[model samples]
Target: MMKVHNRPQNRCFFLFFHRNGQNIGFAMPVIFSSEDGKCFIMEFCIYPEFRGNGTGKECARALLHWAREHGALYAELNYGGDERRCHFWESVGFVENGSDAWGEPLMILPPTEDVPITVEILSDPEDWQLMKLENGFKREIGENALTGEKQKQLQQAVKQGKITFFIARRGYRAVGMCSAAKCYSTFSCWDTAVFEDFYIEPVFRGKGIARKLAKAAQTWCAENGMSSLTVCCAPCDENMYQSLGFDVRLGTTFAHLE
Candidate 1:
């Protein structure tokens, strides 16, 4: 790991990891303001020697903090379909908004805020209390979603704090539910929160309730001191999260090494 410092003179900063004694990587973070808000313009690159060493990710976090401190409403950047590059940015909290004229990936970090919904984090979620979650997963995946394996294992994991279950209610009925978990990123060495099991009743689908629930989940994570919040969304679900100020996981795919 390399130490971070401020270079207010040039509107940029320095990072040294692979070649500490020399000027290894230079990341000049810029923020531009618009009538609506401000966008963080990230002008940066890493030396070949420091490419895979998480140098870019660290610089990104530092820049975002700078933007937040400067009252930036959002952060934006443009990228291409480079899987490695895309992964690094997404894992660091940048999502693709759209492409520029050159077909590059445009990414942004929207400000996080609460929604107009009443939600709570359950400390002890029993089997009976999991009815909404079970049904929601079944509806999204299939009816036999729980036929093979019991959900008790996951329930215990929630109890152990590996996951936190959130439920949104109208009066007394649970209308929406989301499962938030802690995601540890060894690259940035921070816990990035993720929303895994997010579902809202079909009747409540178009009422902006989903976004409210999402915000509630994020609020919980932020209160717990998480650096960023991420949601694994499908193509059809992209617009919803985007409307709620979340970035689309462009050019990103998941894989597990055995």
Candidate 2:
């Protein structure tokens, strides 16, 4: 059944379609009033099988007509993350903006070969210290450091089977740290840092410590059923990461509200 939240004076309609005994699609239309007049249409979706059959365009046109009848001057729908739906929305007169609302560049990486690395799960206090030292390199690059609270949260996540952390070391000195987290259907290499402090420590630098650490994380991710691994870094660090065989892909804009 279609769930429609309707207000007498200012209303929005949610359309749901069912066919052949299967629930297939739904849409949400939002109405807004401003000085420029009223605007409508917030979101829409259709199952893949039901798409491209004129259902979406017809529904959009009907929604627009309803909005205009209710005194709306403009109707808009966003295709921000749905590349497949761009043409469908555009066919109904929606225009693409060069920038997303947050104005961040979008990037994507398809499945690729996972590069192997050797890593050890840190279990000792000394290992933690080494991990901290490795994280300092990220700080130097203006990357955010994992806070104490976050570390604790990650520890809990690890215990709860959400992620795993690996530390690469030479003798007793920790040289690198990598952490991978499971995100629903995929695993993400959350953090991989090789410390400058260890870079000049004579025994850790120039010895593939970073590579080993990365491989260890990859191994853990694979062992836990992740078919691929992904990580992101500053644009300038792309080369360094790519040299390790990470298929570099641009990422979406990152923004924070103050």
Candidate 3:
């Protein structure tokens, strides 16, 4: 049996097996973010033959420890909305987000009305400005818990192809921004955060600036080959998202740890 080690910065893991090993297994760490700097797991898996050998649990624990060591405030995982995986995640202390594979209860925003707003993909040089605006947006939306380092990590994720950022403007001022990343399954959008600063500017409130921005985001996703979209919001903002044609998925859970 040959030994191989592959660990990428974006991925955290230790794989061991033969070059021609049958039923090869994997136990890797999955990382994601919340409104704050906390980390979460969108999914984790091992080969079927290796499931009952206690490898999964060990890997999960190791991953949790890694997250804690990295200063994550909390860790999360989403299981298939089935009896088996659901029970396993619960036993490991993960709660459901009342969402299933589609991550329903997910917010969906409607298309904008071809208004005067201009939307464009953000450039690298603009990251500093984007970060500044995003921080203000986070504060306004009560997501001020994110540390500057974590915010930088988020920006890095975007630059590394792990995420995408879009901005909407009306002349020289940026009115809104949307951050989205490819979902785990390769055909959907997940964790779409429409930053708060993007909300209708005081002078532009109630005129559907957000709707336009969101619509542009959807268009971008679809054009880029994403078949579905999903976004999560606080309970307080559910109505607004629902009004945009997003269906709320039930039975999933969401929690924050201090």
Best by TM-score: 1
Best by lDDT: 1
Clashing pairs in 1: 79-105
- lDDT tens readout by residue for model 1, 50-141: 66666677766776776677666666676655777677778987765433323344565644533345677765656343554555456456
| Residue ranges of candidate 3 with Cα displaced over 4 Å | 1-115, 145-148, 186-200, 248-251, 255-258
TM-score of each: 0.50, 0.40, 0.45
How many residue pairs clash in model 2?
6
| Model 3 per-residue lDDT tens digits across residues 1-258 | 112123333343443332245534544343323222235454466666666766666666666666667655455444434677766665666653322122221111112233376777777723554654565455455564346677668767777877677776654445467766665452333333222234433334566766777777678777877655566677887888777655655434577989
Residue 156 in model 3: shift from native, Å?
1.4
The collision pairs in model 2 are: 104-253, 116-215, 117-215, 117-216, 118-212, 118-216
Which window of 10 residues has the lowest lDDT sum in candidate 3? 102-111
lDDT of each: 0.62, 0.53, 0.53
- Name the TM-score of candidate 1: 0.50
Per-candidate Cα RMSD to the true structure, in Å, reads 21.0, 20.2, 18.7
- lDDT (Cα, tens digit) per residue for candidate 2, span 127-210: 354435434444444555566675566556657755556666433334356666656432244433221221212223466776
